[model samples]
Target: MKFQTIFKTAALAGLALAGTSALAHVGPDGSAHHGFLTGFLHPITGLDHLAAMLAVGVWSAMTTRRLWLAPVSFALLLLAGALLAQAGVAFPAIEPMIAASLLVVGLLLAAQVKLPDAVGAVLVGMFALFHGAAHGQELGAGVTLAGMVLSTAVLHAAGIGLGLGLKRTSAWLPRLVGAMVALMGVNMGLGLLAG
Candidate 1:
């Protein structure tokens, strides 16, 4: 089989492995988790967060002339969100907005849409705020926020790597992943509604 074929198969298998429950974001039961280590692991463990972060990276790499703008925008805005949450500011429809982020980012990746740097930054920045707010509500310490941001950066880098590498193999691979992410977002939204 060709490399592209193999990658397609692998991506499909990954989708199956991802399962429906990956959308669930469980809090740290009993004792609240603190510091960098726990924060680092937070995004990695949650599929919704992981997918959104990576999709931003992949989309930025594929579409943006200024590669760093969108990801940096996302990170900085995420921190601002967390700070907002720590200050006891509440955002309306936080969960719904997070689901929307996945949908928007996934569609952007699938379409390989190219927006102006500032536009792309603003788009991802909006998503980052909700993500940060979610994290902020759970882990309030500065060190924990640092850890989450670090992990998010790593995931974004991995996404960029995936976008670049997959483009070499076949353009469809990233798009496939994007489509899957989008589907996941829809499923999550439905689940939220059902619950």
Candidate 2:
């Protein structure tokens, strides 16, 4: 089958997954959720978090010289950001930054930009702070932070896998996914503006 066909299928599936949840930071009870399972699922369940995290991995794999550096920087800073938030440190414009991360990461992938490893790591790490801060803001009693970090790592790995596998299948396949991710970012930005 054509790569375009596969991209279409994958994009639809991602959107479907994203559409299942409205907010990234809340549970069904409209309260902050904690614990390992909930933390692990948080990144997967939310549209913003899911797209940004996955895109970071894909971009890292496809562009960075050091495959693991970007992801590791993201993970560690994410933990730091969350820890800071847990400590009552507040970051301004957390949501906007998160949305912008999607936009930037998606564009990087679509453009097939090759960034220096440290640069890429720094870029992703900046976004991870915002993401971590957001998660930290809602952290409650339990081991939720650990679960969220694990989940984020998993999502990143999946993206890296997709980047590696799809690149071998068709060079354009990953670009197509990147475009879709960019569109999701645009939609999210517009939503922020509208709301």
TM-score of each: 0.88, 0.87
User: In model 1, which regions exceed 4 Å deviation?
Assistant: 1-20, 23-31
**Candidate 1: residue 113 Cα off by (Å):** 0.8
What's model 2's overall lDDT? 0.78
Error of 2 at 43 (Å): 0.9
Cα miss at 167, model 1 (Å)? 2.4
Give me the runs in candidate 2 sitting further than 4 Å from their true place: 1-22, 26-31
**Local accuracy of candidate 2 as per-residue lDDT tens digits, 78-187:** 88988888777878878778778877888899899998899999999999998888888776534888898888899889888887776678787678677777767777
Candidate 2 is scored at a TM of: 0.87
Top of the candidates by lDDT: 1
Query: Count of backbone clashes for each model?
Result: 0, 0
